[model samples]
Target chain A: MTLTGEFFAFMSLALVAVIGGVLLLNLTKVIHMVVALVFTFVSIAGIYVLLSAEFVAVVQVMIYSGAITIIMLFGIMLTRHHGEEAEPKGGGLRKLLLFLGVLGFGAAVYLGIYDLNFEAVPNTLHENNTEQIGISLYSQYIIPFELTSVILLVALVGAIVLARKDDEKEGDKE
Target chain B: MSSVPVSAFLALALILFCIGLYGALTKRNTVIVLISIELMLNAVNINLVTFSKYGVNPSITGQVFALFAIAVAAAEAAVGLAILIALYRNRRTVNIDEMNQLKN
Candidate 1:
């Protein structure tokens, strides 16, 4: 197949996947929402394959679709409310405003891209992709990488602190 | 079948992203909102990979960054879900508006 044909095929598949994602996201139920997200991640991985980043594409599937979504599912299970009713009605006006805001944001991004001259940068991807990333992360971006770890640590600690409650009721004894 | 244009892929991604953003902002359910955020992030990854394919000689940076994004997203999911569990235990509700004890 010609290069153009290949590109078209990939793009069409991506479009279908994205539409499915949207459908899943709009559903009110949490389980279906996460399932749709799996489709979205897999499709985006296809985009990575089109870009010739095979390793990244595989990693996307393993990490996102495999790990992250399962975590979310467990969270849903853990937090399942017993005999609770459906969610209350949210404000329609607020939803309309949010929809408008996103539309405006998209238009602004499109306009910005339209006006600006995008000079395509050459040699954007390194041959030894994973090795280069490791070098950059450890050598140049070490501090920020470490900071991210610290942030995750803090988040972990915070989660524990917030979840734990003292069992003793001192006021009742008084 | 022929491959689609880059612009078409981007357009679809943008639409998906916008819908996710709207859902995230408008939905009161915490779980739903989190799903929307995931949608937005995936849209961004699509753009990065698409540009990497057609634009340059070496096209791996986008993919590398995407990998990192996925890792961070995993951590985020774990923490966010833990928080949701904690919140549910306390308030017995997952609606965003109701957990307003910190509101001034």
Candidate 2:
């Protein structure tokens, strides 16, 4: 296909994804927000597929849509009060200012990058990219990977400790 | 159909990321904040995978990293919700503003 046509297609998909994300953000009901977020993740996976990362796109759906969203839903179910009204908090002006500040910062960064005519080194996609990645991970990046595992282990322990009830302490005393 | 440009993918990821950030900052519910964080993480994954596909010879690294990220996110969700559950058990409130034990 022509570059112009491709750009138009991408633009449309991007627009849809962006609109979905915004809807997720603006919705007051938490459950609706979660549903919108699922849409956002799926659309992003579509973008990944369009970029030619079919493997990554599938993993995106498998993990984010399958696991993380379900986790968030469980959290919501555990936390939300049954049929209670959401409390109203007033800070509209401050929120608006913060939002505008973020927008300005983003615009400035984009413009600055655009002005700099940076050239990227072109690389072609290979069939054995996944194998190469595995080789590198097991060889050069193994230490960091191990460290990440250890960090996750520590987080798990900490979480369990934090969640432990003090009833045990009272039981020991008794 | 023509191939999609990398820029379009990046732009969508950026917008999703920003909205996630906004939700994280503005939302009071802990669950919502966690979901927003997941959104941001997914945005990063999209960028990594897109670059891997179009800009690199070995495209597998991005997907591998994305997998690692998914694992981390799952761990995070489990631990975060566990903590939230504990907190709810003790205080019966999930509002960040109300959980100020260290505000000396």
Best by TM-score: 2
Pairs with backbone N, CA or C atoms under 3 Å apart (clashes), candidate 2: none
- Stretches off by above 4 angstroms in model 2 are A1-9, A82-88, A113-129, A166-174, B1-3, B56-60
Candidate with best lDDT: 2
Question: Candidate 1 chain A, which ten residues in sequence have the lowest lDDT sum?
Answer: A163-172
Q: Quality of candidate 2's docking, in CAPRI categories? A: acceptable
**True C-alpha contacts between chains kept, each model in order:** 0.46, 0.48
Tell me the interface RMSD of every candidate, in Å. 4.0, 3.6
What are the lDDT scores of the predictions, listed in order? 0.69, 0.71
lDDT of 2 by residue, A1-174 (tens): 366755675776677678778887677777888888787778777776666566667777888888778877877787755423255377587679768876776576466433332234454434555566568679877887897798789778877786676556647989
Docking class of 1: acceptable
